[model samples]
Target: MKDDEPEDTGSTLPRRQLGRLLREAREATGMSLEEAARLMEWGKSTLSRLERGKSERVRIRDVIGLCELFGTDEEKTAAIRELAEQAPVRSWWRSYGDVIAARFNTYLGLEAGASELAIFQPLIVPGILQTTDYARTLDRQYFSRDTDEELDRRVGIRMQRQHIITRQRQPVQLSVVLHESVLRTTVGSRQIMAGQLRHIADLSTRDNIQVRILPFRAGFPAGIVVSQFIIMSFPKDSRGKPVEPTVVFAESFTGDVYLEETGDVRRCRETFRTLQRATLDDRPSRDLMREIAREHDSER
Candidate 1:
């Protein structure tokens, strides 16, 4: 909030993620913040700001210093440095600044950096799996007042986000569990719904993607309504330790929540597993969606 240290909302998520990681590493060594800063030749306040995620900028050298002091392993240290590097890098989603909410912006960054995404939807198709017409229809409904051009831009953003799945370099692994209602519920029109369903089925054939549908006949897991949510985890180190902590994203009518704490992530993860267990296997799920899409086509 200081005059000299202006807000950097664009890279907020990565910076905060980096800060949390650094704080955790320091705590593991039982080093007091003051003592750690002193050893690193950094001002106590400077170190405090980094740990609290208020630093205007993050320095790679400073991050490396802390990693060395904490005796972090090579792969882990490299991962930490990568976070520091990403702290200031602006993401592509920022181009749609006018349409993106602050919280959703945070999600875009996390989604871009994540190595794996596990999503559960009790309603319509998740944005990542949504086709242009389907996304355009939803956007038109939600942004009723917006002009056609604005709506197109919004739809464009959603379509671009799907690229991460198809990206050639270490494309993210995606596991999605959709409620049968998602396929049964027609979005824009029967045509749109059919196309969307087929698109999902096609994508499921990819090596990195798995889409499953939980039928209503299967019953809700534990008779509780599990709303839509996504659990994203970052890439791992050579030793198989996660580079960044897993985060769970839950969206509602009002806003979005990011759960980064260990316990909350664990619980959401278990919930996803429960939903997954109640769903059809990957191949069956893909076939089922294709069949449903054919039904929608017949309706048309």
Candidate 2:
């Protein structure tokens, strides 16, 4: 990291975020990725990976070249370059590479510094809110090919990530909207399911956390085809501007997709608002969670 650059007090420090800015700059200049690669006299894949943040390291000179080519101002150029310098710093997630998906590593980097996280789950509970036993069961089912040790590591990581929700310094504002069915589904065992529901209910009481439940009677929001997704927003900078653009993160069996376009993010925000309108508020949601937990306990 550059000595002069201010400490990363928000989610924008990730190389992925820096790459996004560079990509946007290139697009704003009306230059194609291929055209820019040719103009810079670099291989097309190198430029592609750098812009996509797949490249492990980014050079300050390359960032400067792109900034100059894109006609960025001094302040923006400096911000981008500083992120490049921090790109190589190993994060806590690095140790869990054996269990974490390559595509998810970027999301982890972004999630840690997000100022707000809104998640919509149509099936299982969001991993960030799962209890250790609940997470272990889900991980084992999803990553069936992994060994026991890998499953344990993956569960550990999920639990650790929950700290962001209640962190001492600027805890992330968490808003979760869950489909009613998610509470009804039995993951590991009836006991585990009961514990998980109770845990979420407990978290709902925290000042920074908000939990809502969308009952089946409410029906699905129009134009939202995905089963689950998360929208993460970063805090404002010293200038009172967003540190980074809002990102909507969706994951599938294949890989993770991050949508940073203004239109896409706006639509997602709208969908979340619609769902929020149709769901039970925090108090009722917590009551429903306890009610479901009791159901599970009775089943056990």
Q: How badly does each model clash, as a count of residue pairs?
A: 0, 0
Local accuracy of candidate 1 as per-residue lDDT tens digits, 1-300: 011221223234557767767887899999999999999888999988898667887778888988999888776676567657763432212222222342225577678888889999989899999999999998899889989999998999889999999988889899999999999998888999999999999999999999999998889785687888898877766755555557678877766666655556667878888888999999899899999999999999
Tens digits of per-residue lDDT, candidate 2, 80-142, equal 765676634323122223223432355776788788899999998998899999888877887
Model 1: lDDT to the true structure: 0.79
lDDT of 2: 0.78
Model 1, position 255, has a per-residue lDDT of 62
Worst 10 residues of 2 by lDDT: 1-10
| Model 1 TM-score, 2 decimals | 0.69
Superposed on all Cα atoms, model 1 deviates from the true structure by an RMSD in Å of 12.4
Residue 104 lDDT (model 2)? 30
Q: Scored by CA lDDT, what does every candidate get?
A: 0.79, 0.78
